[model samples]
Target: MSDSNTTHFTNPSTFILLGIPGLETAYAWISIPFCCTYTISVLGNFTILFIVKRETSLHKPMYYFLCMLAITDLVLSTSTLPKTLSIFWFNSREIDFSACLTQMFFIHCFLAIESGIFVAMALDRYVAICHPLRHSTILTNSVVAKIGLAVLLRSGMLTLPFIYIGSRWPYCTTNIIPHTHCEYIAVVRLACGDIRISSYYGLFAVFFVTGLDVFFISVSYTQILRAVFRLPTKDARLKTFGTCGSHLFAILAFYIPALFSFLTQRFGQNVSLHFRILIGNVYLLVPPMLNPIIYGVKTRQIRDRLLQLFSRKWA
Candidate 1:
């Protein structure tokens, strides 16, 4: 542990975070790549949202949930990426306690939102498959609106306590978050105080948001699969699977890294820092880019339309 400091755990004042050994690296070189990732993630997600909003033909419950997801992705990615880029590229990793709390708050809230959004998508698929005739009634405009509102509320209430708990704790001298963002568990782990309460909250967050959401999504898909097997034509079956494939792809891209790192840390598996870094990149960077590609651009009709729109505007 190069950052193995002799600093006391009690009455801590400042933290020294071990950012990716880029203090010696030139800022200009790091900034470029950082900016590029940030730009692409933001632009891609936002473009998806914009096209969904502007195209009235896409006003179904399925795409409505997708638009909400795109909004969540944009918020989730922005909550951490820019700051991470600055830390790596500009060597500006020293985050204030208040700001760290705030960042952690959004990160948690948006992540919860993202998780719920996935559940909502799974439910959408279920209705589309199981109750095709009454799908409109079940997945109505008002219902979808309420579900979106419910997602925000669920996410907000779950994370609000963590924010309050984080604000009250004293941090360890080394403030550097191991991963790029100030996640609740990682952030509180730096605290020198009695972390029993913090750890409990972290566990609660894990079970409440990630674990619960994934559970429901799995349940939703089980029902969806049963319904899928009963579809009349092979073409109908293929189309339904196509709708779900995008969401599942995005979910795997986001969760795989998170699960890997969390398990490695909790189980005391001697994971390498380099390996952790790669996992962190997969968690943060890949989903934001690939999500748009899967749900938006790869949907041939949407891609062709967007390209035509762009060509018309440029010409």
Candidate 2:
């Protein structure tokens, strides 16, 4: 393990990814699950996009947000999974400095964007359930388009600094990262100089994007619940909450694992390195795989459309 005191380079051309530091013997086995995850995530998200595009009845603000979420998930998983698989299956770990920064940027950027989409979806539900009469008016096509653009711009602008800082920083300590992908913190840890700026900025970005998003989502749901309970009948309450079931499941699916992984990565010093890495991989892979499934199962419209499409092919 090379440290800051080791022979340093002003600018290294490439960095080595170690896949999983303590799990070398199981790389082949690990690749199997990750391959399956990537395949399912791609197929599931694409299916969602296809169904949304082809089904006119489904053209609503909620589905529009779902489409945005699907696209973000596609990019988020793609940015890391291919390279991770290469390292696991073929032992190809060398990544160009520029390429590493690009991967890092996309992974983090799409993550923030995905979080923003969840907040959008939550607000959509809040309006639908809380103010059904004005939901359509409030979340107009133009408004949704502006929200999507804002998400993209916000994530890109915030994440660009990570790339800029990573690129300009002198990597004198080492070029080898112990994880599967080129994470910002992992890369910066190799720098020979003080890394307080990078560390502080990363924490700030996380709180600014994810923390605020989570707060908004929570508030949306709280208002939704208040409105839901005000319904006159038990059946009405159940039916109203049922509409939100899928969104709630999707939120837990994405955030629970993600929060765990982030906490373990930052503070779980006693946790096994491989365990932390695996959790990180799970947060990235599992949500993409589960999002479509949760929506398909809990959403009658999507489920019916899926059945119809499959039936046509079979017939």
Candidate 3:
């Protein structure tokens, strides 16, 4: 029977993405919003990169981290959005096995790197607000570059194992993934082999990367808050808090939906498939869209630079 099973089942070379299960009829309608979201994300992040690069006044650790973040967001969204739109618009849902794994790697890798950038941004805030005198020395360009390199190396190393594990799995079962993008667990669950190890490693990676980032960000903000409160004047306190407000909003914009999607994917067994998939897509889409907007509105330097650029263009 085992020999017969082996003879009957072979690994699939490609997998079919179902886009959104149970919402097949609305795929076209859904594609409209997704298309708009991707457009906005691309334009906004590129604007950020452009503004930061052109303005020498914006050359600081904070903006350097912002540049890293902009690049990451671009790659992160690009890794999945085009294919997702293709599936929706052209009914092209088949993804080659190697391509699927590559998609999975970039998606997860940049997500982790984004989390790392948030931590670096939080540390920048903590230093700027709490140790204002030492901020420049502590987070110099050299230090920022080192931190960026470390983030890339860490995310790539941690996520590289997913490719190995994903490739090694024998997929004798159906090659239909229910989600639009090739999410790690969604792809792994299709394997006929036991997936406990993959599942456990995934959970560990999430906790290790996101968990530590969240912890450091929390500590940094706590210290920042303390330093802000200790300022003698209300104006001083407000000024310090203003510096961090954008970072706080960007962090919430990212982690909240991310946490919801993670929870629903893992424990919301009763949740509707379409709802979970939509939330997951939103988690990935909204942050890249919002980060630039939040920073543009809240950070005075960026806002001023944007105004100048627009005014010059109009002139």
Candidate 4:
């Protein structure tokens, strides 16, 4: 293996996150919407956590997975948005190399964890609908705990290489990352060496995490649909479908933007930089905001409990 440091270039100690390239003049104006989105995401995820904690009826296998998902979303959004907001509002974009790496690690790790949680939730739905009698037995507290730990470990293991490899790469080019945060590919592109290995590893990591989770989620839902359609009565089918509506919407919200951004990053080289950045931000922000709303509206138990909680407060 060649020494990564032998490159004839200077590696800067810090990086400048160029939030939304060419839109520097509109940073203040743009921050308003970004702030609103962040605010909503934080509040929404917190509400979901609070409701899950306070409501006894929601203490089930499915809601436990929802709580995990909410926590992941909260962490993922918070990991980047504060720094991004600081850049937009105060022009504080300079980040230490280690800090950038840390942010990048958490951003990708939480995203992977969230994806894993989505798969778990899909599996929960599958077992509930397809194997109702065994759902509780299969997804006990210990089982869910194990699954969460496994997901965290998996995310850490998969993402550690990206950071480890990146930390070793000679970032001798301009330390200006043309996005809101130090994403894996964005930072990797700054290195002044043959980055094909790191690039392919990053691609492999994204595909391994998102692709496999999506595949499993799809399979779970396919089995679920088959089971749902087999219900003897129309009301049974509708009621079973109602239970899954939130998860389906959550699946769509989480995966669509993620896959879009991932594809754009890979294939859309000619795509507008601004559009790519916007979609990346959308992937970061939208699901966290939409998830709680979807669950609050579509999940009947959550909706009734929320109404009851608010009504009691008003009374």
Candidate 5:
């Protein structure tokens, strides 16, 4: 029989995901936190979706954007967490070539979706704060629906090239991916051929998509702060700040680690391999786990609704 580990095809038959190199001995212990985070991510995002759908009072652009965000987090976390847990809990790390590419595609797609949703949310905040009178007229239900579709299409189209180019690469040897998930950069690094194209494109996509979103988010917040400060009373300023606190926290939670991971991988060559891998995993895990909590706690409406939900259950 042919050696199961060796493959004759242009593409390797399977890729082994190395979940946290030098930490295999502690996978059992490490799985505890990962499982807890995954549980919270699923339950929290779904609760946001449920509450938003059930509460017709939340049928507005801001809430709609929150719904989009919740959905993206749900998909993004689910895309990788299950497999990651399998590796940690059961040592099932072998992923087929096509499956690996598919996972990478969805991961990138939803990541871009989340970033686009953040931009939409920023724009929603801008309109609500800066152009209060026109906010309703501009971001009507139909308009919000159109924006949702546009976000999906834009993410899908832009991320297509990532997987397309990745699929064509000649991954002849060293199929072990030294990370918990099939990250774009990690997987590409395993390719036997020249990886200049994949590397450059990944960088371009990161900056073009995430950098643009961060820039717009910054501009939106600047305008929002100006508007808030101009309010006549301290109470008015506090109220405006309160309304935006959740989104600001969400942005920081997602981007800070993401940027750190990217920069460390690209420039921090002296950084330990395990540290880079850990940061990458944290970048993927943190946002999904924290976004719902941030919104639920910071937004009074969501917090009140959640309280009412549990109160009813208890009663």
Candidate 6:
């Protein structure tokens, strides 16, 4: 298996995904739970997006960004999971190179959008908290729309190179992928041709975007802390921080697993593939599951609204 990767082969055919090994015995039971969770994630995110669009009260910058994030979640979860579950249940794990690259394209695109929207949301909260009087003026609808466009343009452009790079690298005869979806790094690492450019470009892009976003988030929070301390009333400071707490939690939850996965990939080459797959799932799936829950907890108004909706439905 190790030597097979280096030998170039012309017939780059269909690949089999060796989904988390040894779980086949319980595949039936696993499918049921996985399908339920996946459906709920997609449905919940779609519902949030709808509610945000339908409710005029959520037209503010924060909720505008939340709606965008919901859209990202819906697309991201939908793009990767349903097919994966189908493969697990039906044993239809074969995928051609072109299809794999397409999957890789959306994965990175959605990831970039996720990070971009998160940074924008954090900035929105910072402005709202530190400059409450001018919040409406600063976060105008036009401004929010521009931010959304910029994120889409930037993420889409950044991922185009990846598509080009993928096209150039011919696959070897060995046709086994280790995980469910076409992870960018994992896919590129399998190429028989030179991947120095892809590796360099990818690492630099990840560090540049995710790193800069983290830095900006840190700076925003620092300013927020200073502003909070100067508040005359404790209640005022708490309220201000509370506004951003959800965004902060979501950022941490999403970024930490991602950073860890990439770092381990770079340095922990000797680690078992099973562990890597476990962390990969955590990186991909956990964030979407946590984002809405975190926001629901942090924002009392949103929380109350969701609870009221659920109660009315269940009653």
- How does each model score on TM-score? 0.85, 0.95, 0.94, 0.93, 0.94, 0.90
- Score each candidate by Cα lDDT: 0.74, 0.89, 0.88, 0.85, 0.86, 0.78
How high a TM-score does candidate 3 get? 0.94
lDDT of 6 by residue, 122-216 (tens): 78877976898999998899999999999999899989999888777877756578787777777777778678998899898789879887888
Clashing pairs in 4: none
Query: Candidate 2 lDDT, tens digit per residue, 13-62?
Result: 89999989978999888999999999999999999999999999999998
Supply candidate 2's per-residue lDDT for 254: 86
Taking every candidate in turn, the Cα RMSD to the unseen true structure, in Å, is 3.7, 2.1, 2.1, 3.4, 2.4, 2.8
- Which candidate comes out best when scored by lDDT? 2
Model 4, span 1-315: residue lDDT tens: 345534333446788998999888988888888889889988888887888899987899889988898888888889888999999888899999889889989988998998999899888889988888998899999999999999999999998998898888877636789999887788888888798998788789888988899899999999999999999999999987876776687778888888889788767999999789888888888888888787655677887877888999999
The CA-based lDDT of model 5 is what? 0.86
Greater TM-score among 2 and 4 belongs to: 2
- Give candidate 5's TM-score: 0.94
Model 4 poorest ten-residue lDDT run: 1-10
Over 52-163, each residue of candidate 3 has an lDDT whose tens digit, in order, gives 9999999999899988888898898899989999988899999998899999999899999999999999899889888889999899999999999999999999999999
Cα displacement (Å) at residue 122, model 2: 0.5
lDDT of 1 by residue, 54-116 (tens): 888878888888788878877777777777777666667677666777877887787778788
Reference-based lDDT, residue 42, model 1: 83
The Cα RMSD of model 1 versus the native structure comes to: 3.7
Model 4 segments more than 4 A misplaced: 1-11, 242-246
Ranking by TM-score: 2, 3, 5, 4, 6, 1
Model 5 residue 222 lDDT? Answer: 94
- After superposition, which runs of candidate 3 have C-alpha atoms over 4 Å from their true positions? 1-11
